[model samples]
Target chain A: MATKRIVVDPVTRIEGHLRVEAVVENGIITDAFSSGTMVRGLEIILKGRDPRDAWAFTQRACGVCTTVHALASVRTVEDAVGISVPKNAELIRNIMEAALYVQDHVVHFYHLHALDWVDVVSALSADPKETSRIAQSISHWPKSSVGYFKDVATRLKTFVESGQLGIFANGYWGHKAMKLPPEINLLAVAHYLEALEWQKEIVKIHAIFGGKNPHPNYLVGGVPCSINLNEVNAINSERLNHVSKLITDAMQFVNQVYIPDLMAIAPYYKDWGAIGGGMENFLCYGDFPTHGYNQTDSFKFPRGIILGQNLNEVVEVDARDPQQIKEYIKHSWYKYGAGDEAGLHPWEGETEFNFTGPKPPFDQLDVQNKYSWIKTPRWKDKAMEVGPLSRMLVAYAAGVTEVQDIVNDTLARLNVPVGALFSTLGRTAARGLETKLIVGWLKGFFDDLVTNVKAGDTTTFTKEKWEPSSWPQSCEGVGMTEAPRGALAHFIKINSGKIENYQLVVPTTWNASPRDPSGQKSAYETALIGTPIADKDMPLEILRTIHSFDPCLACSVHLYDPDGKHIHDIKVV
Target chain B: MLLLNPEGYMQNTKINTTLILGIGNTLLADEGVGVHVANYLNQKKLPDFVEVVDGGTGSFVLLGIMQNADRVILIDATIDGEKPGTIKRLTPKFSKDYPKTLTAHDIGLKDLLDAFYLLDTVPKVILYAISIAPLAEGLSLELSSEVESAIPEIVDQILKEIE
Candidate 1:
């Protein structure tokens, strides 16, 4: 077979444009590069705007995880302005975020990633009864099993009939990589529809609180909407119960349906475990810190820092420290001065239109023209891994008993020993498991809010009083939040009260990121190095791995309408 | 004024769902015009499943309702080469020749509705189009007077559609 590179530009259903380029040698992928083609300057565009607007604008950066961006943007501004949100506000935000988290994870698993593994065409061969049995074996819920599959068929039919392949258009149903019996495929297909409904329910929580999903209205001081007792009770009882059931159902599905499905499918594609698995250097800024303990302190959810390949002896991340962070744009197309000089806060950043052709694989020294609008973010002089896998690994290593036990059990079950549990599959599992933990955390948060409200905590939002003079001349702080993908950090600097500099080190920036100087590869890049590729064009393995990372380009930078194409110009051009 | 608020900001107002189409590019230019109008209708608490739409481009996307709707009021752009603020209400009869422009995104409203008719999705949807000025530039709409002026009539027609 003649060797050639295949570029799947603008991978569909993802938030933004991305090109997956790879070198093929005799039908094998010798090298691959994931490039983000869109350059969004939202970070810079956000400067000097009423910081409150960040809530609205930042979330627009990524549609999939818009809620996370909104929450984080609020947090970033709150941290910058120093405002302590009310308990109700915190709980509301927590619930909304958790809802989005579950929704996004479910959507990722069934809709996005599952298509790679679950063969859709095979479902035609499935016995609807056996499929129901397969679904039942996973978990028994009150829903009519027969009706569920029937609804699945109807919805699929409606979708096809709608002339909108809105979700499942590009599925490689008959691909060689797809493995799973018809019965299991049908079960998963049914679950996929269920997940969609669940996603709508979860998003409603946002609509109730934030007014809408996908760019829900959040405020710097607090959320714009309030929850009365009736609303709260309704959510706590009926809605929350349903959500809880869904989570539990999902866990059962993971253990029974997905795990078995993975196992059943793994044998056919054993080669995937080896490919797209990058350096295990994970970095988690941590989440759900108690009242007094800073993020560094261990809590129900712990912060994570993995210095190197050895996942043990987790390090602590200090947001106040500037020495540990530097964003290397050398390997990227950004025009930065020589070695170690590329790192700068976002406001003082440079925005130049320079398109250098794609750099060859393993060429870490070149800076002239690089692919991808994504920047290479480094923590403590290293490209650290961020996401559920990173968070879980940190939690497990830091002795979070529940996570540790789950990790151990899952690893033992896989028979690959307790170690490599931090690989591709591990990452996906971590995201799902993290949702379970977050839900519990949020329920408790709601309970605390009720208590606080009963105790007369009327301060849902506090106005930050800042004497213009009192504002620091220049200050830098790393704002870290748990985006759906993983840990997101924004190291911002304000000079004379305007945003003098800003740098967003996104979770994907670490995980799906490319290689950097010193020849250190990104977590995703390294992960892909060892994988064997059968067909370069049909880079299913690479897509699966990248999807595992759940890359969102909008959250990182600013995207502007560069050329306003009036209709006349559009035609002429 | 069409006062399109796809974001649904006006809940106390009166809105009938006889005709609703959301038009806008959640991704591109002042295309969100239809979404704004639909959202506005929604906020005003229009009839359930009011014909609200993001409309995007491709006014023809509304073709399915042409015969079904006794009177269609389509809210869109007015490219009369007039001042930027000019908005106009055009009741192009049910005989087709409706304007064809969708937002820069995929599947124009015309093609979408045409497909619906071709596929028999909604063979009897009437068409109501409001024309403002700008159709390109970016996501945010540049509302013109004619666009704004047509809102009340559009709302009235929508109520008529529902009635």
Candidate 2:
């Protein structure tokens, strides 16, 4: 009967740290506040540095999105210096980006988000034979034998009974809102383990090209992998073939395991198709360039903005236009030179630390005052959602035939209307659908690279403009990439070949930012407003909506607090 | 035609069975002591089986390296009310056995360990937790002088272990 405030800090199973504070009135979320607990550590680390070496450091900023960050950083530096990459280099970069999408999306669904839908405890009681039968009916992924299902159930039972759930430890298991059947849960659990094995293979594309996986090496002018199709220790036919095999494997995994699992899981929770539909504005700085980054029309994802929930018309998005894209520090722990009310574009962005919040070991944030580590990012002073759903909607609206076919086919298969694309289900489904299309694109990029290499053009690097001496005294440029989470971009101002100011408006900064000066909430907070919490203690419903964004606000200081012991993840007050 | 690299992700890095993994954010002052120590060790000579990795903040991507590794020595900063540079060695079998460090990637490391539980191969992992004060304002690539002073002792301990 009374309004209660529920807080889920360090929301588990995400790439980064996210704290969600929801105001529940009469079992439904009336108001919600989302805070990224950690500051953007890279902002201060990257100031007044040589722009050429940024790719290595920026890639370490996020926990999982090293490739995307590296890509953005290099692209920004290249844009600034006017360093044009060879076709082989661009194709290789596309392949790596595409590989990341396949791996990131699948990992998000299984390891990160699937626990919300499929209960591990429930899976323990499932009939292996039935799970195998259901698996066969939906997908032909070879790990669907009855014995395999039985083994998975046994392993899960052993884990659950071990009194140490570890990764599965923080899950709000057996929540009333968790709707998947025992067999389906078991099937999902089986794939969760298998997906981990499959994802490691995907990153080899990064290693083959970038030199390593965790923090791969990157050059400003072009990719590090030089091409020599015949040499044993080069980007030869063997390595290219290896890339091809990874792409083929990814295609099969997405088509068979991921898409089928999504369809199978969607019918059970069609109610979610209407819930957690946040804003009407979506923006995407499209990626996978066919004609190069400058040509938006050649982008496989297609660059554009959809305003007021209009799927028919898309407005142009200009990241460089100082008026078009801007960031505000209001309702955030950052301060701008002009003031809180003024939104500065990325080129003029500031990294002033202004921590003004309640000390930790506290209950809730001062919502009326400054809160959250993420700065509010805006497109022409309007809050916009940017991610897989944003990308899909923009592509589908722009009449990308492949995206349309998949979107239409998915809608028809689920028998849901087009409006359902606005909700939590839509966001989650969009990621899988986009992954399906990207794998196909990955194949095309691979083929194109092979064709070019076979035509005796093995040039992957351009020495022109690679030196800092070639640049003007000062120049500014912006590099945008569609990260697995959303539209991620970096803007840099180079003065005399040194980075005067560097600003990264990441996916999480846009999605998880707090209220603006005008009191407008970002995607994460807005999506949680109407979510009905079945039980206040275990807010499974809240995680469903929040995790849909694939919130990647990581790099939280990994402080080992022994005295101030805080055990619970979701604290309700 | 995926050419099989017998060595794991470390084929790019020096492929080794023994790994000295450092976990931290270099941007933070003392928080990056692990990486600082790893960088210090990377310059020095060590056993051929050992590979020093700046496992900056620990991600799922590091699992590729761990899959091939037989033994891992991890160094990270911890806030346990001890002296700023006090070192504690721990042999953690499961993710639950370690101290609850609060980073999004710390969760990933724990999840990475938990992921190993799902697989048949589990690497033997040892952690050297360096005690330090809580996070402070103003980011710096340089470690605090006090924390920086303790690196030699930590490096000596690591050298003895590898020896």
Candidate 3:
């Protein structure tokens, strides 16, 4: 048997650059790697700049998820200053976050991830009438209008005719792995175009409140904009209702269209689950609050720290543990102090550029750590994963009845028992379900804003004389927020009222990270170890598993061209 | 050259197909001349279809703009290898790397002519480059003897792009 490898450097459609490499032996994946290719010196740029400007600069690291970075940076500042956000501020932040989820999830499923499964060429073979019937069957999304579908077909036709293939150039259409019949593909294709329009409108919700969709402005103490009675009323009645309706319609579409599509496509490609499912270790910081805004009291999705291949549960980990979190710059271009002293808290951190290749594992684990700019993040000397699947699994295990029912019911439909819902597919499905639940919460948050307005307390903006000296000096604080991908934290120290040092333990740092000092693999990398590399020449299945983590490389801003540098000479003709 | 300003800023002339290329290093310090100029052009409210780009320090990229423009004006901090502030104007024919060390940010411009040649989408091109001596790190521009004196002349040349 012969093996072939197919590598697509700079995976298009997603924000930033991604390089995917798969090792295939006899039509099965023996190995795979998802490499982040772009180098952004955000950490270096942040050094010596006014701490307040970090919110502006760091957020631009990745335009797609800039909101998360901004919120994380602001939270870090708040933690250092030791100022408690007002209740209104909490509610506003929660609403803004919920809006981001609605926008991000919808866009990802339709634009970026959908291309993996939906075949556009197959859509051309579909009957228009049948396409309409299938779309209506899936959900009553207004964008699923027949006229809109026709327009989509026309635009796609022109795009293809133009021969530029802007977004569709890299897609694999004729592969045997494409499972859906022509009509279903046609329906999905139509929805994909409709999704583009719907996403544009949905982004308006971000602009209305936060100033922009990709990156939004949020004040630390409160939101930048004040809520008048009209604005408060409009937020719930118009903007939020529109968003909630989209969510409802989207959930229905997933149930009626996506799941059925996934199952239909699964048998044609039964080898996926076995290939890319890396180490079973899962982690999630948790989202949604049952009652209050306090991080500790609002809601607790039981923390999970899985050890080894046994999948055994251990004690919950703390976010504030400095010893648990260590950064090894040995392989990175950034130089650090001698071994065991390489790790520095965010406030006292030093970022110096030094691009070198792989080195020995930092901790004492027994695995070969290789590839990726993201450092392995451990919890109390143990490598733990972080993302939606982890959060869903922890919630389901703790018997969060809402998520449990959805997972169990979905599993029952799939003919698998409830226990099987603890796997990768379950984690992916949980993200969609969580979006539905969060949409409901957003409606309530909007309603409460109106209530606060009626009580004559719509005063949301606060302008105070802030002196740098007033903020804490020489103190460590953990800033955590549930970024769209997972939990994001910024650890920092302040000395002389300036950022003495800072460290960002981002979500991808946990998911796409390399192995730890103990030689324990990062969650996604560990998951990849057991996955059979199928059809190395066509690594779509491998991509699905990797993208499920939604890795963000901009946060880990160091890059190297190991394959030798010959710029592709991109000509914009 | 004809200058036509919509708001009477250029009431005395007529402007057509003006390609105002702003050049600078967005990541590098004072080298962001193009970005600042582009931002100013965006706010100045030019006529329809006027193209303005944050060209940064990529000269090879200028070939594309050069091919397809009625007129082109470039804004950059030039370290002429002359006196710090001296401004020089020469119709630089294509040398291997006309603008040596084009920044990574605007490297896209390096392949401009190649794109036009392959795609057959060439247009009439013109260029106006400025020589700001100091391209240091930090937002503020540090002008040398001759480079500082060239700002007014550069602005006049930019207004001339529309003319």
Candidate number achieving the greatest TM-score relative to the actual structure? 2
lDDT of 2 by residue, B1-34 (tens): 0112423452433344688888877766787788
Tell me the spans in candidate 3 whose CA falls farther than 4 Å from its real position. Answer: A1-6, A38-40, A142-155, A212-214, A230-275, A287-294, A299-315, A340-350, A357-372, A418-424, A461-465, A532-534, A556-573, B1-163
Q: What is the TM-score of each candidate against the true structure?
A: 0.75, 0.96, 0.73
Candidate 2 runs further than 4 Å off: A555-568, B1-16, B102-106
Question: Highest lDDT: which candidate?
Answer: 2
Tens-digit lDDT track of model 1 for A484-542 = 78887665555566665555566777665556666676766666555555554456766
Per-residue lDDT for A1-573 in model 3, tens only? 775554655444444345555555666656544555334245555655556656765565543566777777777777667656655666677777777776666566665577677787777666667667766665644555667666666666665555443345456777666777777777766655544434434444454566433356777555766655345433333544444554455445445544544544443333343444555566655544444324544664445454443334444656666565566543334555555325644444555544444332221221233355555456655666676666666666666688678666666656654444444454455566666666666677766765676677765644442467666555555667777788777766666666656667777766666545555556565555545433444556655666666656644332112221222211111
True contacts kept of each: 0.00, 0.35, 0.00
Per-residue lDDT value at A130 in model 2: 98
B27-91 per-residue lDDT for model 3 (tens digits) = 43334445565666766766665766544333332332344455565555444344443334434
- Return the interface RMSD of model 1: 10.1
C-alpha RMSD between model 2 and the true structure: 2.6
Model 1, range B1-163, lDDT digits (tens) per residue? 1222212222213333344555443333233445556666766755444445433332221332332333334554323345543344444322223443322221233333433332333433444444445443122323545555556666666666676
